[model samples]
Target: MLVGPRPLTFVAVALAAAIVVNSEAASAQPDAGTSQAAKDAARELATKGIELYHKGRFAEALEQIQQAEERYAAPTHRVYIARCLVGLGRLVEAKAMYERLGSEPRPREMAPAVRDAYGAAATELTALEARIPKVAIAIVGASTGAELSIDGNPRPLPAGPIDVDPGSHVVVVTNGERRAERRFSAVEGAKVEVRLELAEAVQEEEQGSLVPAIVLFSVGGAATVVGAVTGGLSLAKVSELEERCVDGHCPASDQDEADFAEALGTTSTVTFAVAGAAVVTGIVLAVVRPGGSSANTGAAATSAKSIVIDPVVAPGFIGVRGRF
Candidate 1:
């Protein structure tokens, strides 16, 4: 997530400088038996830190405040430290400091400067609450050994929401050899939900076996040859019957031949049509190869709109019919 720099106004700088001055001035007038040297050193560090903060040297300011904290513990220094963290774009740490300070009860003997620091912490916490974002993850059909990570840091599959800073984030889920990744941007105060479904990993069988195609081709070719022979015999019988016929009238002696020829023609037509369809289907299967693509692993689908074959039988016509 990207955070734009907040504009610093004169009023803010004046208020921060006033806190530093007031703290140093208060510590300068030490009580009897107090270690004036140690208090003076802390006051000097706090002053330097405030100068750095005003100069926009957040890193240096943070170091100075840390040094002051080491020298002398003060709630006011924590306020400066949190401000430095915000300036350095360490928002999560800054937010924690703000939260901690906001929850603490105000001390009874708190100086006006310390009271002002606590007030500032409260204000900063309110702003941070609006800037932080949250994410919720939902996994569907998560297999055993499935792992999830955010920004390369592994985390347990969360049952609830997780807070994050406003910015770009990467979410990844892995199950066995299969993996899924997504990149998303989170806006300030946004509650984003990412749903992922793990895909099962399975070995794919080889394609283009050609065994079924070969078998169908052989069966269809034999039927076609048989049908051709029957059709030729039928044609010869018809010619012989024509010779016996006069004025479209055939003698009773040719009746048996005529009936046999008709049967042969009908059988030839039916056989040819079925055989042609089988051969065509075989060729299509050889070319297409159902469930062939490596990218496709799901169950196959069936449809009714497919190739069909029928016989064409009419007066002076005997052939196969194909429809797609």
Candidate 2:
């Protein structure tokens, strides 16, 4: 909201007076390529902005004035911009613009209307310089290498009391894993200390379902059971070898059986390890949600995400398959 309904009424009146320039001056583009049509459009916009300002619509008025400035160049436009900022409670910016226009050199033959606008700017400067609020923004619990900003502009850490307009604003602090924000308001001649803390840990909420984990563990258990049963059958071959290899001597027939027993032992060891790893992985998916994808959770997470894991086992080999 604009402060005090008619806070910058005198300057608003100057806006009405400034646009009374002749066609040649009004058509002067800010850059080389702007057409006369654009200059005319800009004038229309500026006129609209001025009317809006008179009605206490500072935001709408500022929008129009900005568009006009972009299309055509004019020293008088600065006058309206400064006043709009003042009405919008952005006194710091208004004061700076006013100071700049006051010190800027101009021709003796300049239009009287423009001259009056500059005069108004100079007068405004004197009154606003002392009323700008000061804010001492502080950050707490922010991670190393975290960044802080005010209204989207980055600020150095420990940046002491800064000049601000008397209005509402938001300060933000962010690290890769956590973020925090603080909103505050300021009044003329007031000093404020504001703190933004990034102490909340950013965690992904569980999304999707437990179906994937359940399937993975079930397949892993099945593989383990198959490996165990095969190993038990190999015990019969082991006992026969023990009888045949008496006195540390065995026939060639025993070699094939011994080889079969060793194969069973290898399969048991591999399948058991693979099964344990699968179970552990499944448990992890069930417990911890990834910020981006795992068991998707939070506002952005979608139920349509797909994940599958299955353990494969055969008589002589074992493997796994999954899509994430």
Candidate 3:
């Protein structure tokens, strides 16, 4: 974010001077009683107006200043009235009054006050002419008082039409642990809007556990080992039968020979069955583990929503009050 030039303070100072000048002029007039009354009235009104202005009550200040102007006809009083108008956003009237004041020459003592007032008006006009672009960011998921940062610099919430260089910027919106980011481009005098929604954090524990997968692999390995042993035993039995029976006499009728062949067949069948079951069990276990790509069968779980980023002209960040 780019910082703009500070507003000129002369206008406000001139207004103060005007109020003092008018009060003093009223006091100096002939006829002590009437002059004293006018001075008292002007002083009271100007004091109230100044107080109101300080309190950010520009509208009320305008009212008070207007009343003072009606009760008195003095250039000094008019200057203050104009200042009040400027504070109230009535620029046209304020400009006219400032212009009128600028045209007249002032006494040596009043010269500084006049110069200050002119300077303030000139600063205001310069600011107005520049027309700084304002962007409003409304965050929905965070609280209104959530902190806002632009390119790592903290900025006040409900910020003014921020005067920014015409270019791109990175905006970060954060509240406690939740955070969102976006990029935007702005042109001179253009308003940019942005809205952000933070994604909830995903806990590691919720992802499937590796324990089940490890257990399955262990079981499978044990089964495979047992199957290989059984297969070896079956092959040995067959080899022994053939060796003892000689050529083709491997025992159709011989009880020992028949028994040996039956034992071998049974062992081979059992071994294959155990191995197949183990392999299937291992596969199932791997699929059930947390973080596995396959769907889990144990329990239903929820996942965080994916964040969406879109370009906008205005600030786009919001916050929620409670934790998820």
User: How high a TM-score does candidate 2 get?
Assistant: 0.48
lDDT of each: 0.70, 0.70, 0.55
In model 3, which regions exceed 4 Å deviation?
1-131, 176-178, 197-205, 246-268, 290-324
Please give, for residues 141-180, the per-residue lDDT of candidate 1 as tens digits.
7778989998998989787987776789999999878777
lDDT of 3 by residue, 86-115 (tens): 555554456566566556544444434444
**How do the residues 1-324 of candidate 2 rate in per-residue lDDT, one tens digit apiece?**
222223345544444444444433432222465676876777778778877877879899989988988877666677778888888877888888888787766655555556666667766777777788888987778657988788888977665898877888888888876788888998898999998777767565545566657876886798789778777867877887888786988898778889999888777777776787677667755653322343334335542244454555455555556565
Return whichever of 1 and 2 wins on TM-score: 2
Residue 114, model 1: lDDT of: 64
Model 1: residue 180 alpha-carbon error in angstroms: 4.2
TM-score (C-alpha, index-matched) for candidate 1: 0.47
Error of 3 at 300 (Å): 2.7
